[model samples]
Target: MNNFKTESFDLNRAFLLDSSHPPSSIVTKLHPLNKIMAEGQIHEDIPLLVMELDNQAIAFITPQLAYQHIVQGVLNGQAWLVSFCSICNGGAVFSPLVDDEVYSFQEGGFYDAMVLLYDVQSGSYWDHLTGNCLYGSLVGKELKRLSNLLHMSLRQVLAAYPDALLALSALPEQQQTEAEEDEAWRKASEPEWSKGLVKTLGVEDNRLPRLNMGLGVWTETTRRYYPVAQLYAMNNVLIDMVDGQRLITYIDPLSGTPGAFFTDASQAEWQHNILQLNNGDSMRDMVIFDANMMLKRPQRPFQLFVRWYSFALKFPNCEIYGQPVNTQG
Candidate 1:
């Protein structure tokens, strides 16, 4: 029930390819088998934000690339912003258009404990979560969000779209090297909560550790948090009611990221760790399933995966699941 505008931003700039090191498209050389092998060598447990464009799948979007605000062009002259904040474990994909002009975003340091994004077009800062232009020419403008993003493992993505193209394989050699260096630097600067690494401006919740990962969902009047550890303890799936909507949340046991969907259907039963719906449909991957039992096409009531601390800082009134209830009489 969040009362927000859903107007589509004008796409003046069709693409935002890095000027000095333009990305090369290798669709002809992309094969599922080969890309899967390369991804396995890097890390099978790492998740990728997978999207389908013009019947071709765009995969191999690592968290490192997201943290770097790497904008890549896909089919139909559309560009995608793969954004991730390492400090808060916040990951989201957005269309890079603000107003009529397409903008390229880079890490613009931090503002109020949240990552601020700087656009090359207007030199404005934007809030990554809300997509609001905080400063510069396009102030108060918001970015449009793309739908049906499969934030799951590369293996699951390849299995779902066997013919999906590997976008990372097309990245320039020098850019690839720079991406590796950025990841290394990030790892070396792990947040230390004891030293006040994560700061919250307002009241705080002490229900869980500040650094734990939490999947957050916000409605117009309510906000909810699902801690990763609690989801794992609940057999990797939690069916709950939020803001009068019934939601089924699934957490990949291997990757630990959560994806949720709305379904009036009963709780899905698991056999051999595979989710089986009442209509005889079975799912082996972490992609959200719709009411029709189709995978990768998540229905209404989507959720955002982020760190517990970030959720608390952004939505302090959010209800935390799995907190111990008082039983003493």
Candidate 2:
């Protein structure tokens, strides 16, 4: 409601030349197969096209449409703060309560997400070539498209979490037979609990790590001085924080309410949150702690998807090692 924007992805049908392909309904719904078919129409492979990049996927939807999504989805009700910590970079504590000029958290919203602009381009900490805006709308598309991408993006999965473990939730009780267990969920989610992780990771079957995210990404960095991600079979998708890596965690529940973006917050505050999430100097410190709730509502998950991807970009040489944990029947 703060401003308006738009883009479109209409599902169009295609008749395949191969009769061996499964029935149309099931074929179109299949992950790898469907993604391959959809790519020719979408103009690019959504998986590699979106996933190969770093920092918020940089969706190139129209600028106005992108900003509208930002305002409505997350900029509406959020609050923001900047760090003056000497660790990351000693600078301003600029808060909405303090200065209203250069750092306004009151009502004077930013003209653009960047500090400087030309005919229309803006300066950025990332994406120098594209001039992509950092607001959540333009960047945070991964979370929204996770389920779709997991199937379409790549045919193979590489489960490379630091602990070398996988937690597939939404499974069956031991009392049930193996065949019955797999059939019960029927691809609703990853196996509720998989046996291979315990055997392979050397973790006790009865033991699992408790959730302790006080350090945010710092603890994750301890294992490797960079971001880490491990792929699991769709049936092995997890709902809880898994081991030292909480792969599927969502934002604080309060931050996920509908219309959280700019709804109760002032325009200036909304814009401030956008900057902090995108490339504000203080954002670097955020990786050390939870920092403030940056996005308004649903985007917190999507935003993390981008940030994690960005972190990986920072480590181009990130060693990709680890034996693949098989999830097939």
Best by lDDT: 1
User: Per-residue lDDT of 28-107 in model 1, one digit per residue for the tens?
Assistant: 34346445567564466565766565556666556445545544454557766655665565655567876666676777
lDDT of 2 by residue, 1-329 (tens): 00111123111211111222221110011123223334542222222111111122211111111111111111122222211111111111111221222111111112211111111111111121112222323332111112111111211111111111111112244523542433343222232333431221211111112110111121223211111122222211112222333332212111210111111111111222221222221111112112353422121221112222222222222222232332222
Flag clash pairs in model 1.
2-220, 12-100
Q: Candidate 1, which ten residues in sequence have the lowest lDDT sum?
A: 9-18
TM-score of each: 0.72, 0.20
lDDT at position 305, candidate 1: 72
Clashes of each: 2, 19
lDDT of each: 0.59, 0.19
Worst 10 residues of 2 by lDDT: 83-92
